[model samples]
Target: MRTTLNIEDDVLAETKVWARRQGLSAVQVVFRLLRFVLSGGMEQAETGSAVVAGFRRFQETSPKLVTNEQIDQLRDQVGL
Candidate 1:
């Protein structure tokens, strides 16, 4: 099927790069990525297209970075 769709430039570039490394064609990569997207395999609800790579939180090493003052302020504002 032939159709037109808009895609981000960086996505296409990364796909091409991955395809080259994996020895898969761009079409195959796109099909796989589309399936992943449609299947909701990515868990990051706020960032579409993240499902292809899965969600990864960068907070693992900085879990205690927030100050208690900020936490208390937000808690009071939210009536928590």
Candidate 2:
């Protein structure tokens, strides 16, 4: 499975750096990224979840427990 791609210079540079930091070769990194994208990983990222090391995906939640006024009041009471 040998092929050629025309990747942007900046994109390739960043991918190389990321691959080095993850202890993976550039080809491995590119392969995994392509697999992930083809397997709907981008949808998860768009929906506020991310895949982390060890193949774990976590959802981000924001519960509206307090309003801005409450936060401001608390900040003022804290003397700052």
Candidate 3:
């Protein structure tokens, strides 16, 4: 995965600092960080805990149906 990336100067400097702190090369730091983010590990890191049950309950519920009659009524009410 050798490719040229146009990273910002500030971000490059930060990565270098992080690499030194972790005793890793810049490439290793970048790949490890990318893996953590892409694998959804960043969510856990930000929350400081694992996801709880019943989280995002809306995702499990069915969506409401908007009838054409309701749409027409709304259009008329709004002078559309």
Candidate 4:
């Protein structure tokens, strides 16, 4: 990929330093980090952990209203 990227000089320098520290090419470091983020793996793991940790916080909250059983609902009322 012989393309130009307009990146901030300081950030690019820092990325180069980190890449060197990891013994990975700058491109490899960028790609791996991007995959870890954009693949949804990172968010999914964080969300799952947060859900488990915070679920107890909602234990005291009550629903303001209630409706019929979802599975037995009359779909035609809402034109579903």
TM-score of each: 0.48, 0.57, 0.57, 0.48
Model 4 per-residue lDDT tens digits across residues 23-79: 998888878878987766565565553344334224325556546665347676677
List residue ranges in candidate 2 displaced over 4 A. 49-80
Q: Write the per-residue lDDT of candidate 3 for residues 1-80, one digit (tens) a residue.
A: 57899999999999999999999999899999999987768766766665567242233256799999999999999999
Off by over 4 Å in 3: 49-80
| Prediction-by-prediction clash tally | 1, 0, 0, 0
lDDT of 1 at 17: 99
| Candidate 2 accuracy as lDDT | 0.82
- Runs of candidate 1 with Cα error greater than 4 angstroms are 44-80
lDDT of 2 by residue, 29-76 (tens): 999999988887886777656555525444547645788999899999
Each prediction's Cα lDDT score? 0.77, 0.82, 0.82, 0.70
Clash tally for model 3: 0
Residue pairs in clash, model 1: 42-51
Model 4, residue 61: C-alpha shift (Å): 19
lDDT for 50 in candidate 3 is 59
RMSD of 3: 8.9
Model 1, 1-80: lDDT tens digits are: 89887879998899899999999998899998888767766545444335445554443444567899999999999999
